[model samples]
Target: MSALDFIPELGHRVRESVPRLGAATRFLVLGLGRPFHRHFSIQQWLRQVYGFGVLSLALMVVAAFFTGMVLGFQGYYALVRFGATSALGTLVALSLLRELGPVLTALLFAGRAGSALTAEIATMKATEQLSAMEMMAVDPLAWVVAPRLWAAVFTVPILCVIFDLVGIFGGYLIAVPVLGVDSGTFWSQMQSNVSFRGDILNGLFKALCFGLVVAWIAAWQGYSAQPTAEGVGNATTRSVVAASLAVLGLDFILTALLFS
Candidate 1:
Protein backbone atom coordinates (compact mmCIF):
# COMPACT_ATOMS: atom_id res chain seq x y z
CA MET A 1 0.00 0.00 0.00
CA SER A 2 1.12 3.49 -0.82
CA ALA A 3 1.71 5.97 2.03
CA LEU A 4 -1.39 7.89 0.96
CA ASP A 5 -3.52 4.81 1.49
CA PHE A 6 -2.41 4.55 5.15
CA ILE A 7 -3.64 8.01 6.13
CA PRO A 8 -7.29 7.01 6.24
CA GLU A 9 -6.44 3.91 8.29
CA LEU A 10 -4.57 6.06 10.79
CA GLY A 11 -7.53 8.39 11.09
CA HIS A 12 -9.82 5.43 11.64
CA ARG A 13 -7.69 4.20 14.51
CA VAL A 14 -7.69 7.66 16.07
CA ARG A 15 -11.45 7.85 15.79
CA GLU A 16 -11.78 4.49 17.51
CA SER A 17 -9.88 5.80 20.56
CA VAL A 18 -12.22 8.74 21.12
CA PRO A 19 -14.55 6.92 23.46
CA ARG A 20 -11.67 5.87 25.73
CA LEU A 21 -10.52 9.45 25.85
CA GLY A 22 -14.03 10.56 26.77
CA ALA A 23 -14.23 7.93 29.47
CA ALA A 24 -10.93 9.10 30.96
CA THR A 25 -12.16 12.66 31.13
CA ARG A 26 -15.39 11.55 32.74
CA PHE A 27 -13.50 9.55 35.37
CA LEU A 28 -11.42 12.57 36.23
CA VAL A 29 -14.51 14.72 36.78
CA LEU A 30 -16.26 12.04 38.77
CA GLY A 31 -13.39 11.88 41.19
CA LEU A 32 -13.67 15.60 41.79
CA GLY A 33 -17.31 15.26 42.80
CA ARG A 34 -18.05 15.47 46.51
CA PRO A 35 -14.30 15.78 46.99
CA PHE A 36 -14.69 17.13 50.51
CA HIS A 37 -16.96 14.44 51.89
CA ARG A 38 -15.16 11.61 50.13
CA HIS A 39 -11.87 12.92 51.45
CA PHE A 40 -12.99 13.00 55.08
CA SER A 41 -11.76 9.60 56.26
CA ILE A 42 -9.71 10.88 59.09
CA GLN A 43 -7.48 7.91 59.89
CA GLN A 44 -6.69 6.99 56.31
CA TRP A 45 -6.17 10.58 55.32
CA LEU A 46 -3.86 11.23 58.23
CA ARG A 47 -1.71 8.23 57.42
CA GLN A 48 -1.38 9.20 53.76
CA VAL A 49 -0.61 12.85 54.53
CA TYR A 50 1.96 12.21 57.23
CA GLY A 51 3.46 9.21 55.50
CA PHE A 52 4.42 11.13 52.39
CA GLY A 53 5.49 14.14 54.48
CA VAL A 54 7.94 12.24 56.73
CA LEU A 55 9.34 10.17 53.90
CA SER A 56 10.24 13.20 51.79
CA LEU A 57 11.44 15.58 54.51
CA ALA A 58 15.18 14.86 54.37
CA LEU A 59 15.58 15.60 50.67
CA MET A 60 13.46 18.74 50.87
CA VAL A 61 15.39 20.10 53.86
CA VAL A 62 18.75 19.63 52.18
CA ALA A 63 17.52 21.17 48.95
CA ALA A 64 15.98 24.19 50.71
CA PHE A 65 19.07 24.96 52.76
CA PHE A 66 21.34 25.02 49.73
CA THR A 67 18.79 26.99 47.73
CA GLY A 68 18.63 29.70 50.42
CA MET A 69 22.41 29.87 50.77
CA VAL A 70 23.00 30.23 47.05
CA LEU A 71 20.31 32.86 46.64
CA GLY A 72 21.70 34.86 49.55
CA PHE A 73 25.26 34.81 48.21
CA GLN A 74 24.23 35.54 44.67
CA GLY A 75 21.59 38.11 45.50
CA TYR A 76 23.75 39.86 48.07
CA TYR A 77 26.79 40.21 45.83
CA ALA A 78 24.74 41.49 42.90
CA LEU A 79 22.85 43.98 45.04
CA VAL A 80 25.96 45.18 46.84
CA ARG A 81 27.72 45.79 43.53
CA PHE A 82 24.77 47.93 42.51
CA GLY A 83 24.69 49.68 45.93
CA ALA A 84 21.24 48.19 46.58
CA THR A 85 22.11 45.83 49.43
CA SER A 86 19.12 46.94 51.50
CA ALA A 87 16.82 45.26 49.03
CA LEU A 88 18.30 41.79 49.66
CA GLY A 89 15.62 40.91 52.16
CA THR A 90 12.90 41.94 49.75
CA LEU A 91 14.33 39.79 47.00
CA VAL A 92 14.77 36.75 49.24
CA ALA A 93 11.29 36.94 50.69
CA LEU A 94 9.63 37.48 47.34
CA SER A 95 11.55 34.73 45.60
CA LEU A 96 11.09 32.14 48.35
CA LEU A 97 7.53 32.90 49.39
CA ARG A 98 6.17 33.37 45.88
CA GLU A 99 8.05 30.87 43.76
CA LEU A 100 10.77 28.67 45.15
CA GLY A 101 9.05 27.13 48.18
CA PRO A 102 5.86 25.82 46.54
CA VAL A 103 7.28 24.98 43.11
CA LEU A 104 10.25 23.01 44.37
CA THR A 105 8.24 21.16 46.98
CA ALA A 106 5.67 20.04 44.41
CA LEU A 107 8.30 18.85 41.97
CA LEU A 108 10.01 16.86 44.69
CA PHE A 109 6.75 15.36 45.86
CA ALA A 110 5.78 14.35 42.32
CA GLY A 111 9.07 12.60 41.79
CA ARG A 112 8.92 10.80 45.13
CA ALA A 113 5.29 10.33 46.16
CA GLY A 114 3.62 10.47 42.78
CA SER A 115 5.76 7.72 41.34
CA ALA A 116 5.28 5.59 44.44
CA LEU A 117 1.50 5.97 44.42
CA THR A 118 1.21 5.07 40.75
CA ALA A 119 3.38 2.02 41.09
CA GLU A 120 1.60 0.83 44.22
CA ILE A 121 -1.89 1.09 42.78
CA ALA A 122 -0.88 -0.20 39.39
CA THR A 123 0.67 -3.27 40.98
CA MET A 124 -2.46 -3.93 42.95
CA LYS A 125 -4.50 -3.70 39.77
CA ALA A 126 -2.24 -6.09 37.97
CA THR A 127 -2.55 -8.58 40.82
CA GLU A 128 -6.37 -8.60 40.69
CA GLN A 129 -6.80 -6.88 44.06
CA LEU A 130 -8.43 -3.85 42.50
CA SER A 131 -10.86 -6.07 40.64
CA ALA A 132 -11.69 -7.92 43.83
CA MET A 133 -12.45 -4.67 45.58
CA GLU A 134 -14.91 -3.88 42.83
CA MET A 135 -16.55 -7.29 43.09
CA MET A 136 -16.99 -6.83 46.83
CA ALA A 137 -18.98 -3.57 46.33
CA VAL A 138 -16.30 -1.41 47.92
CA ASP A 139 -15.81 1.88 46.12
CA PRO A 140 -12.14 1.89 45.20
CA LEU A 141 -12.31 5.60 44.55
CA ALA A 142 -13.16 6.21 48.15
CA TRP A 143 -10.91 3.50 49.57
CA VAL A 144 -7.92 4.36 47.41
CA VAL A 145 -8.07 7.74 45.71
CA ALA A 146 -9.85 10.05 48.18
CA PRO A 147 -7.56 9.45 51.13
CA ARG A 148 -4.44 10.18 49.09
CA LEU A 149 -5.90 13.35 47.68
CA TRP A 150 -6.96 14.58 51.10
CA ALA A 151 -3.61 13.60 52.54
CA ALA A 152 -1.77 15.55 49.89
CA VAL A 153 -3.94 18.59 50.59
CA PHE A 154 -2.81 18.48 54.20
CA THR A 155 0.78 17.33 53.64
CA VAL A 156 2.09 19.58 50.86
CA PRO A 157 1.55 22.92 52.66
CA ILE A 158 3.27 21.52 55.74
CA LEU A 159 6.13 20.47 53.51
CA CYS A 160 6.32 24.00 52.08
CA VAL A 161 6.81 25.37 55.58
CA ILE A 162 9.75 23.05 56.08
CA PHE A 163 11.10 24.26 52.77
CA ASP A 164 10.74 27.94 53.70
CA LEU A 165 12.28 27.52 57.12
CA VAL A 166 15.31 25.64 55.80
CA GLY A 167 15.70 28.09 52.97
CA ILE A 168 15.61 31.06 55.37
CA PHE A 169 18.19 29.36 57.55
CA GLY A 170 20.34 28.83 54.50
CA GLY A 171 20.21 32.52 53.74
CA TYR A 172 20.95 33.22 57.38
CA LEU A 173 24.09 31.08 57.39
CA ILE A 174 25.44 32.80 54.29
CA ALA A 175 24.38 36.37 55.01
CA VAL A 176 24.88 36.71 58.76
CA PRO A 177 27.84 34.73 60.08
CA VAL A 178 29.66 34.19 56.82
CA LEU A 179 29.11 37.48 55.02
CA GLY A 180 29.19 39.62 58.18
CA VAL A 181 25.58 40.74 57.88
CA ASP A 182 24.17 41.71 61.25
CA SER A 183 21.80 38.91 62.22
CA GLY A 184 19.23 41.23 63.74
CA THR A 185 19.43 43.58 60.79
CA PHE A 186 18.99 40.70 58.35
CA TRP A 187 15.95 39.17 60.06
CA SER A 188 14.33 42.49 60.87
CA GLN A 189 14.75 43.56 57.28
CA MET A 190 13.12 40.35 56.20
CA GLN A 191 10.21 40.96 58.51
CA SER A 192 9.80 44.63 57.77
CA ASN A 193 9.98 44.34 53.99
CA VAL A 194 7.90 41.22 53.54
CA SER A 195 4.08 41.28 53.53
CA PHE A 196 3.19 38.19 55.53
CA ARG A 197 -0.55 38.30 54.90
CA GLY A 198 -0.12 38.35 51.17
CA ASP A 199 3.09 36.42 50.54
CA ILE A 200 2.65 33.66 53.11
CA LEU A 201 -1.01 33.12 52.38
CA ASN A 202 -0.43 33.00 48.64
CA GLY A 203 2.44 30.56 49.02
CA LEU A 204 0.38 28.19 51.15
CA PHE A 205 -2.53 28.45 48.77
CA LYS A 206 -0.35 27.51 45.81
CA ALA A 207 1.11 24.60 47.73
CA LEU A 208 -2.34 23.24 48.50
CA CYS A 209 -3.40 23.42 44.88
CA PHE A 210 -0.18 21.74 43.79
CA GLY A 211 -0.78 18.87 46.20
CA LEU A 212 -4.25 18.24 44.81
CA VAL A 213 -2.99 18.23 41.25
CA VAL A 214 -0.16 15.86 41.99
CA ALA A 215 -2.21 13.40 44.00
CA TRP A 216 -5.10 13.39 41.55
CA ILE A 217 -2.90 12.75 38.55
CA ALA A 218 -1.07 9.97 40.30
CA ALA A 219 -4.18 8.22 41.57
CA TRP A 220 -6.06 8.59 38.31
CA GLN A 221 -3.32 7.18 36.16
CA GLY A 222 -2.64 4.28 38.49
CA TYR A 223 -6.25 3.22 38.96
CA SER A 224 -6.91 3.30 35.25
CA ALA A 225 -3.75 1.48 34.25
CA GLN A 226 -3.88 -1.46 31.86
CA PRO A 227 -3.27 -4.95 33.17
CA THR A 228 0.43 -5.22 32.58
CA ALA A 229 3.59 -4.39 34.46
CA GLU A 230 4.74 -2.28 31.53
CA GLY A 231 1.54 -0.29 31.77
CA VAL A 232 2.30 0.31 35.45
CA GLY A 233 5.74 1.67 34.61
CA ASN A 234 4.29 3.90 31.95
CA ALA A 235 1.65 5.18 34.38
CA THR A 236 4.31 5.98 36.94
CA THR A 237 6.36 7.96 34.44
CA ARG A 238 3.31 9.76 33.06
CA SER A 239 2.08 10.56 36.56
CA VAL A 240 5.30 12.40 37.33
CA VAL A 241 5.35 14.28 34.04
CA ALA A 242 1.66 15.23 34.14
CA ALA A 243 1.73 16.24 37.83
CA SER A 244 4.82 18.44 37.43
CA LEU A 245 3.40 20.15 34.36
CA ALA A 246 0.09 20.81 36.11
CA VAL A 247 1.85 22.29 39.13
CA LEU A 248 3.85 24.73 37.01
CA GLY A 249 0.94 25.67 34.75
CA LEU A 250 -1.36 26.22 37.70
CA ASP A 251 1.31 28.24 39.48
CA PHE A 252 1.54 30.71 36.61
CA ILE A 253 -2.23 31.14 36.40
CA LEU A 254 -2.54 31.53 40.16
CA THR A 255 0.28 34.09 40.39
CA ALA A 256 -1.32 36.20 37.70
CA LEU A 257 -4.75 36.01 39.30
CA LEU A 258 -3.51 36.72 42.81
CA PHE A 259 -0.88 39.39 42.14
CA SER A 260 -1.71 40.92 38.81
Candidate 2:
Protein backbone atom coordinates (compact mmCIF):
# COMPACT_ATOMS: atom_id res chain seq x y z
CA MET A 1 0.00 0.00 0.00
CA SER A 2 1.01 3.57 -0.58
CA ALA A 3 1.98 5.80 2.37
CA LEU A 4 -1.16 7.89 1.96
CA ASP A 5 -3.36 4.78 1.93
CA PHE A 6 -1.65 3.49 5.07
CA ILE A 7 -2.16 6.79 6.87
CA PRO A 8 -5.92 6.74 6.43
CA GLU A 9 -6.05 3.07 7.37
CA LEU A 10 -4.17 3.79 10.55
CA GLY A 11 -6.47 6.65 11.37
CA HIS A 12 -9.53 4.53 10.69
CA ARG A 13 -8.25 1.79 12.95
CA VAL A 14 -7.58 4.31 15.71
CA ARG A 15 -11.04 5.77 15.36
CA GLU A 16 -12.66 2.35 15.56
CA SER A 17 -10.65 1.32 18.59
CA VAL A 18 -11.27 4.58 20.45
CA PRO A 19 -15.02 4.00 20.73
CA ARG A 20 -14.53 0.42 21.81
CA LEU A 21 -12.13 1.56 24.50
CA GLY A 22 -14.58 4.22 25.65
CA ALA A 23 -17.42 1.70 25.82
CA ALA A 24 -15.33 -0.64 27.93
CA THR A 25 -14.31 2.19 30.23
CA ARG A 26 -17.93 3.21 30.63
CA PHE A 27 -18.91 -0.37 31.41
CA LEU A 28 -16.26 -0.57 34.12
CA VAL A 29 -17.34 2.74 35.66
CA LEU A 30 -20.97 1.68 35.63
CA GLY A 31 -20.13 -1.76 36.97
CA LEU A 32 -18.25 -0.22 39.88
CA GLY A 33 -21.01 2.30 40.60
CA ARG A 34 -24.11 0.10 40.51
CA PRO A 35 -23.27 -2.08 43.53
CA PHE A 36 -23.44 0.93 45.88
CA HIS A 37 -26.91 2.00 44.78
CA ARG A 38 -28.58 -1.39 44.46
CA HIS A 39 -28.70 -4.77 46.13
CA PHE A 40 -25.21 -6.24 45.99
CA SER A 41 -25.46 -10.01 46.27
CA ILE A 42 -23.00 -11.35 48.80
CA GLN A 43 -23.36 -14.88 47.49
CA GLN A 44 -22.42 -13.87 44.00
CA TRP A 45 -19.39 -11.97 45.26
CA LEU A 46 -18.33 -14.98 47.33
CA ARG A 47 -18.64 -17.28 44.36
CA GLN A 48 -16.51 -14.99 42.27
CA VAL A 49 -13.96 -14.79 45.05
CA TYR A 50 -13.78 -18.56 45.19
CA GLY A 51 -13.40 -18.72 41.44
CA PHE A 52 -10.84 -15.97 41.03
CA GLY A 53 -8.90 -16.41 44.26
CA VAL A 54 -9.28 -19.82 45.82
CA LEU A 55 -9.01 -21.80 42.60
CA SER A 56 -5.68 -20.20 41.76
CA LEU A 57 -3.99 -20.66 45.14
CA ALA A 58 -2.14 -23.86 44.34
CA LEU A 59 -0.44 -22.44 41.28
CA MET A 60 0.56 -19.30 43.14
CA VAL A 61 2.06 -21.32 45.98
CA VAL A 62 4.11 -23.51 43.69
CA ALA A 63 5.36 -20.53 41.71
CA ALA A 64 6.29 -18.67 44.90
CA PHE A 65 8.08 -21.65 46.41
CA PHE A 66 10.33 -22.29 43.44
CA THR A 67 10.94 -18.56 42.98
CA GLY A 68 12.18 -18.30 46.55
CA MET A 69 14.37 -21.37 46.25
CA VAL A 70 15.96 -20.01 43.10
CA LEU A 71 16.51 -16.65 44.77
CA GLY A 72 18.07 -18.34 47.78
CA PHE A 73 20.37 -20.37 45.59
CA GLN A 74 21.40 -17.37 43.49
CA GLY A 75 21.52 -14.79 46.28
CA TYR A 76 23.55 -17.10 48.54
CA TYR A 77 26.24 -17.53 45.94
CA ALA A 78 26.28 -13.83 45.07
CA LEU A 79 26.50 -12.74 48.69
CA VAL A 80 29.09 -15.37 49.50
CA ARG A 81 31.46 -13.76 47.05
CA PHE A 82 31.43 -10.67 49.25
CA GLY A 83 31.50 -12.55 52.57
CA ALA A 84 27.89 -11.48 53.18
CA THR A 85 26.23 -14.92 53.18
CA SER A 86 24.46 -13.97 56.41
CA ALA A 87 22.45 -11.46 54.40
CA LEU A 88 20.74 -14.21 52.41
CA GLY A 89 17.52 -13.90 54.37
CA THR A 90 17.30 -10.16 53.86
CA LEU A 91 18.02 -10.63 50.19
CA VAL A 92 15.38 -13.29 49.62
CA ALA A 93 12.77 -11.56 51.75
CA LEU A 94 13.29 -8.18 50.16
CA SER A 95 13.28 -9.62 46.62
CA LEU A 96 10.07 -11.55 47.17
CA LEU A 97 8.25 -8.86 49.17
CA ARG A 98 9.23 -5.99 46.95
CA GLU A 99 8.98 -7.46 43.47
CA LEU A 100 8.64 -11.18 42.75
CA GLY A 101 5.67 -11.82 45.04
CA PRO A 102 3.25 -9.36 43.45
CA VAL A 103 4.57 -9.64 39.89
CA LEU A 104 4.58 -13.43 39.64
CA THR A 105 1.29 -13.82 41.48
CA ALA A 106 -0.44 -11.43 39.11
CA LEU A 107 1.06 -13.17 36.07
CA LEU A 108 -0.22 -16.49 37.35
CA PHE A 109 -3.61 -14.99 38.14
CA ALA A 110 -3.77 -13.54 34.63
CA GLY A 111 -3.05 -16.91 33.07
CA ARG A 112 -5.46 -18.84 35.29
CA ALA A 113 -8.29 -16.69 36.68
CA GLY A 114 -8.16 -13.81 34.25
CA SER A 115 -8.24 -15.98 31.14
CA ALA A 116 -11.05 -18.07 32.62
CA LEU A 117 -13.07 -14.96 33.32
CA THR A 118 -12.68 -13.72 29.76
CA ALA A 119 -13.65 -17.08 28.34
CA GLU A 120 -16.67 -17.42 30.62
CA ILE A 121 -18.06 -14.01 29.81
CA ALA A 122 -17.33 -14.35 26.14
CA THR A 123 -19.11 -17.70 26.12
CA MET A 124 -22.09 -16.14 27.82
CA LYS A 125 -22.17 -13.54 25.11
CA ALA A 126 -21.73 -16.14 22.40
CA THR A 127 -24.59 -18.22 23.80
CA GLU A 128 -26.95 -15.22 24.00
CA GLN A 129 -27.19 -15.44 27.78
CA LEU A 130 -26.36 -11.78 28.09
CA SER A 131 -28.95 -10.99 25.47
CA ALA A 132 -31.60 -12.90 27.40
CA MET A 133 -30.67 -11.00 30.55
CA GLU A 134 -30.96 -7.78 28.62
CA MET A 135 -34.39 -8.86 27.33
CA MET A 136 -35.39 -9.55 30.92
CA ALA A 137 -34.35 -5.97 31.82
CA VAL A 138 -31.34 -7.15 33.82
CA ASP A 139 -28.13 -5.16 33.67
CA PRO A 140 -25.30 -7.50 32.85
CA LEU A 141 -22.60 -5.17 34.16
CA ALA A 142 -24.00 -5.10 37.67
CA TRP A 143 -25.09 -8.73 37.65
CA VAL A 144 -22.02 -10.16 36.03
CA VAL A 145 -18.95 -7.91 36.00
CA ALA A 146 -18.79 -6.02 39.29
CA PRO A 147 -18.56 -8.97 41.60
CA ARG A 148 -15.70 -10.50 39.67
CA LEU A 149 -13.82 -7.21 39.54
CA TRP A 150 -14.19 -6.59 43.25
CA ALA A 151 -13.40 -10.19 44.05
CA ALA A 152 -10.13 -9.93 42.15
CA VAL A 153 -9.31 -6.63 43.81
CA PHE A 154 -9.78 -8.16 47.25
CA THR A 155 -8.26 -11.56 46.54
CA VAL A 156 -5.03 -10.63 44.76
CA PRO A 157 -3.45 -8.88 47.72
CA ILE A 158 -4.23 -11.80 49.98
CA LEU A 159 -2.67 -14.14 47.44
CA CYS A 160 0.39 -11.92 47.24
CA VAL A 161 0.80 -12.13 50.99
CA ILE A 162 0.54 -15.90 50.87
CA PHE A 163 3.08 -15.95 48.08
CA ASP A 164 5.51 -13.84 50.10
CA LEU A 165 5.16 -16.06 53.16
CA VAL A 166 5.58 -19.28 51.21
CA GLY A 167 8.56 -17.80 49.40
CA ILE A 168 10.24 -16.91 52.68
CA PHE A 169 9.86 -20.43 53.95
CA GLY A 170 11.19 -21.77 50.68
CA GLY A 171 14.19 -19.52 51.02
CA TYR A 172 14.71 -20.63 54.60
CA LEU A 173 14.51 -24.28 53.64
CA ILE A 174 17.29 -23.89 51.13
CA ALA A 175 19.37 -21.28 52.91
CA VAL A 176 19.34 -22.95 56.33
CA PRO A 177 19.59 -26.73 55.98
CA VAL A 178 20.87 -27.12 52.45
CA LEU A 179 23.31 -24.20 52.32
CA GLY A 180 24.37 -24.40 55.98
CA VAL A 181 23.38 -20.82 56.81
CA ASP A 182 22.33 -20.29 60.43
CA SER A 183 18.54 -20.18 60.90
CA GLY A 184 18.73 -17.48 63.53
CA THR A 185 20.86 -15.25 61.33
CA PHE A 186 18.48 -15.67 58.37
CA TRP A 187 15.40 -14.69 60.37
CA SER A 188 17.19 -11.99 62.31
CA GLN A 189 18.68 -10.33 59.27
CA MET A 190 15.32 -10.32 57.45
CA GLN A 191 13.54 -8.94 60.51
CA SER A 192 16.06 -6.18 60.94
CA ASN A 193 16.37 -5.15 57.30
CA VAL A 194 12.86 -5.50 55.92
CA SER A 195 10.49 -2.79 57.07
CA PHE A 196 6.73 -3.34 57.30
CA ARG A 197 5.82 -0.17 55.42
CA GLY A 198 8.64 -0.18 52.95
CA ASP A 199 8.51 -3.80 51.82
CA ILE A 200 5.28 -5.49 52.82
CA LEU A 201 2.80 -2.66 52.46
CA ASN A 202 4.32 -1.42 49.23
CA GLY A 203 4.19 -4.90 47.76
CA LEU A 204 0.55 -5.23 48.73
CA PHE A 205 -0.16 -1.92 47.08
CA LYS A 206 1.45 -3.24 43.90
CA ALA A 207 -0.71 -6.34 44.12
CA LEU A 208 -3.89 -4.27 44.45
CA CYS A 209 -2.97 -2.21 41.42
CA PHE A 210 -2.07 -5.28 39.41
CA GLY A 211 -5.32 -6.97 40.38
CA LEU A 212 -7.36 -4.03 39.18
CA VAL A 213 -5.54 -3.96 35.86
CA VAL A 214 -5.84 -7.69 35.26
CA ALA A 215 -9.48 -7.94 36.26
CA TRP A 216 -10.47 -4.85 34.33
CA ILE A 217 -8.79 -6.09 31.17
CA ALA A 218 -10.34 -9.54 31.47
CA ALA A 219 -13.84 -8.27 32.15
CA TRP A 220 -13.72 -5.61 29.48
CA GLN A 221 -12.40 -7.95 26.81
CA GLY A 222 -15.07 -10.54 27.55
CA TYR A 223 -17.90 -8.07 27.80
CA SER A 224 -16.95 -6.51 24.49
CA ALA A 225 -16.07 -9.72 22.66
CA GLN A 226 -17.71 -10.56 19.36
CA PRO A 227 -20.47 -13.09 19.86
CA THR A 228 -18.75 -15.99 18.13
CA ALA A 229 -16.68 -18.99 19.19
CA GLU A 230 -13.53 -17.69 17.57
CA GLY A 231 -14.08 -14.29 19.11
CA VAL A 232 -14.38 -15.84 22.56
CA GLY A 233 -11.11 -17.66 22.12
CA ASN A 234 -9.42 -14.50 20.89
CA ALA A 235 -10.72 -12.52 23.84
CA THR A 236 -9.41 -15.07 26.30
CA THR A 237 -5.98 -15.01 24.68
CA ARG A 238 -5.92 -11.23 24.61
CA SER A 239 -6.90 -10.99 28.25
CA VAL A 240 -3.93 -13.05 29.37
CA VAL A 241 -1.47 -11.24 27.13
CA ALA A 242 -2.77 -7.78 27.98
CA ALA A 243 -2.92 -8.47 31.71
CA SER A 244 0.64 -9.79 31.77
CA LEU A 245 2.01 -6.77 29.93
CA ALA A 246 0.03 -4.41 32.11
CA VAL A 247 1.35 -6.07 35.25
CA LEU A 248 4.97 -5.68 34.17
CA GLY A 249 4.52 -2.16 32.78
CA LEU A 250 2.59 -0.96 35.80
CA ASP A 251 5.14 -2.55 38.13
CA PHE A 252 7.80 -0.25 36.73
CA ILE A 253 5.56 2.80 37.08
CA LEU A 254 4.49 1.81 40.59
CA THR A 255 8.05 1.17 41.65
CA ALA A 256 9.08 4.59 40.37
CA LEU A 257 6.17 6.26 42.14
CA LEU A 258 6.42 4.30 45.40
CA PHE A 259 10.20 4.21 45.72
CA SER A 260 11.19 7.48 44.14
Best by TM-score: 2
Which pairs clash inside model 1? none
Best by lDDT: 2
Query: Residue 112 deviation, candidate 1, in Å?
Result: 0.5
TM-score of 2: 0.95
Task: State the lDDT of candidate 2 residue by residue for 75-134, as single tens digits.
Answer: 999999999999999999999999999999999999999999999999999999999988
> What value of lDDT does candidate 1 attain over all alpha carbons?
0.84
> Which regions in candidate 1 have their CA more than 4 angstroms from the true location?
1-29, 32-40
lDDT of 1 by residue, 96-143 (tens): 888999999999999999899989889989999888988987766767
Query: How many clashing residue pairs are found in candidate 2?
Result: 0
Ten contiguous residues with the weakest lDDT in model 1: 31-40
Tell me each candidate's TM-score: 0.87, 0.95
Task: Evaluate all candidate structures by whole-model CA lDDT and list the values in order.
Answer: 0.84, 0.93
